[model samples]
Target: MKKPHLIVPEGMEFIRDDIGYAPAVLAGNTLYISGQIGRDDQRQLVVDKEAQFVMVFENMKRVLEAAGGSFENLVEMTSFHTDMRDLPLFMQVRDRYLQGVYVAWTAIGAASLCGAPGYFLEVKGIAQLN
Candidate 1:
């Protein structure tokens, strides 16, 4: 059995202290990333919808990198959005970060997220590490 390894990327300390959850956890070849929101390093949520969408991916990228993975390594992704109307904006931002890698993804509409008021979306993913 492989032991679970917590991924604590630099500049992501706020997630640990404020949320009490690891940004990501590596078990064997798989990395399970926690739901990432649009909050900055200071734990402040971004106000703009488009900007917030981008920030979610950016936060996930940091965790993936820390786990020795990249966007191309992602095998599945699930996103939670406060409004389904923002799907277009979220897709645009996702394309920018994911490039052409086509991974299994699902987007769900949610009423809100924990600790992030005014945030429009959150994303979590599973990645295969090399």
Candidate 2:
């Protein structure tokens, strides 16, 4: 049986230790990532919708790289949003990062997130490592 390895990427802030959950985990060839909010390196929540969207993806990118993968390695993704109407804006920011890289995706509308009040969205995913 393959053991699951907890992945803690350098330079990324994880509240998991203080709270309870890993940012991501590697089990076999798959990397499972937890939901990433638009928190900055200093742990401040980003208020701008577009900026927050970008930050979410950037955080995901960092996690993917730490797990020895890239945006192209992402097989699936799920996004939770406080407002579904921001999908267009979210797509705009997402396209800038992905630049045509395609992956299975899901978007969900939620009333609120765990601890982020001004946060507009959260992104999580699964990546296949090479």
TM-score per candidate:
0.93, 0.92
Q: Across residues 1-130, which tens digit of lDDT does each residue of candidate 1 receive?
A: 9889889889986545665698888999999999998988887889988888888999999999887789999999999989999888888999999998999999999998874469789899999988
Clashing pairs in 1: none
After superposition, which runs of candidate 2 have C-alpha atoms over 4 Å from their true positions? 13-15
lDDT of 2: 0.87
For candidate 2, give the lDDT of residue 67: 89
Model 1 ranges off by over 4 Å = 15-20
**Residue-wise lDDT of candidate 2 within 46-118, one digit each (tens)?**
8887888999998998899888899888889899999999999999988887887898999999999865588
TM-score (C-alpha, index-matched) for candidate 1: 0.93
Residue 49 Cα positional deviation in candidate 1, in Å, after optimal superposition: 0.9
- lDDT against the true structure, per candidate, is 0.88, 0.87
Per-candidate count of clashing residue pairs (backbone under 3 Å): 0, 0
